[model samples]
Target: MTIMSSTSLSSGLDSVTNKSYLLHFLQLLSTCMAFFLVTRESTWSVDISNWSMFVWCFCFAVTLLTLIAELCGLQDKLHFSWDRFLITSACYCALFCLSAAIIYPIIHLQIFPDGSPRHHVIAATAFSCIASVAYAVEVVWTCARTGEPSCSLLGLLKRLEIFVACVIFAFLSNTYPSERQPALVWCVAVYCICFILGAVAMLRHRCDCDESLPYSCLGFGQSVLAVLLYTTALVLWPLYQFNGDFGGQPQRSNELSCIDELTSYLCVWDQRLVVAILTAVNLLIYVADLVILTVVSDRGSTQGLRIPSSY
Candidate 1:
């Protein structure tokens, strides 16, 4: 009986390990290919290619490290939950690859000279897309297979909020025209603050230290704060960027003057619009998170107060 039980357990472990290994291996392979293809082109004048290379290299390194750590059982020695960390990392990697896949082609392909090798860009974009899909699948599979309460919908939301903030940061990094404007600075602060809070929440949960914290209260409070801050940003950003009275462009300029290298990647006007939209999207997400938390907490409290009949 003991021999049979050990054999069954070993088979289960092997099945689980095999799936994870295959997924991470695929992610590493695709990211490596994408990175190599882009670097081989040796085109750095565009500037945006740097971001592409960074994304591919980052994903490849992280995936390789994760696979190694898991295979060697190093995760058991970590202070935090390895599964949670993996899920969060995979989610961000997926988004990063997806953005790279989209942006790399848009910025480089159109600008490629007729005699230049555009196929490299095309192949790199394809590999990035594959890496993105693989990472996304890994996240979903891990969450579903583990079925950990911490990897629930709330966890997904937290990771998503962080990802959106990252995208906003990337767009803002292209240029900081709002540097002198206090309102825009405050908007950026809002993004930073909310992102930090979400990251903290994830950290606390993954580290198993949140049990002592008033989790529900803290989550609700943070959600409210995020909603308010994002609402302010959602209104202020568009006003300051699109209003003609503020010396802002009311429409995307079609003038060739807007066709410079910087604008070719993403114009200031378009970046502002994209940031505003993302802010609104995050605001809605926070509001949904708030509502869901409230409902869930209420249910929990009600269940706790329920009287059990004599059994």
Candidate 2:
């Protein structure tokens, strides 16, 4: 074909691809909105708050990322990626815990002084563990449902275990006697968990899975954007909720503190920004995948991919 013909064809293809991407994005957004509304326990439901949106968005992001990756031939199979889900879950768990550490301490320094208890710290850790385990169960279930290696392998499950363990350690770093060193230890734990698990999620590894993201779907650009969205939702939005250590009181309480010390961090104000942050990040990832698929329509273009797909 002539150069002009080739350019026109490329432009046409790009336009069609963009339209399809937008359509797919709309569809996913609509579905996740419904899911979020229903899954939102009534007590936790609020208009546009942190706890309300953080994890809600995160899970949606992970699933959405999987779908986009599939479209770009990024996955061995198109179903939800358990490994991706677990890493994201752990990262969000860390974020939720950190939000708790900051918002909680400031919210009740007068009442708790020493800063709640080791229970809150531990409970947050347990939350990450449970979330990781839950996702592993999901991975196993997906494999069972599909009868494929994607779900059957223990490598991904074990990798998830590694993330969960890291999260637990990070959280426990603060669960020591409260008075000795509370805020600093807890905050450090949160950062540690976020960096370690978030890095793993953004990259990825298990069995034969390639750790780096697809050139089209993820990069420093997308990762930074995800973090920005998360920080905006999870940590920043809650500043308004504060008013001198008393305004935002816990509306809920952890009944399961006995089940595990970490599980006990539950309180009314435990609403975290994780759901929102995750949602935003996942949404971005999916968009990135679409862009990649559109821009690099053939194997030839992917020669630029120094790293393989993380789907």
Q: What is the TM-score of each candidate against the true structure?
A: 0.87, 0.29
Q: Which stretches of candidate 2 lie over 4 Å from their true place?
A: 1-31, 34-52, 71-142, 145-187, 190-265, 268-311
Q: Please estimate how well model 1 matches the true structure, expressed as its whole-model Cα lDDT.
A: 0.75
Off by over 4 Å in 1: 113-116, 207-215, 254-257, 301-311
Which window of ten consecutive residues has the lowest lDDT sum in model 1?
Answer: 302-311
lDDT of 1 by residue, 1-311 (tens): 99999999999989989999999999999999988877777644464456778788888989989998988999999887787677688888999999989878887777776544588888889999999999989877876767444444555566678888987887776445656777778888899999998878767666222232224677778888999999999987887777878655676765342577545546655667778888999888888777766766756532232112210
Displacement of residue 126 (Cα, Å) in model 2 is 22
**To one decimal, what is the Cα RMSD in angstroms of model 1 from the true structure?**
5.2
* Candidate 2, residue 275: lDDT: 26
Q: What are the clash counts of all predictions, listed in order?
A: 0, 28
Q: Model 1 clash tally? A: 0
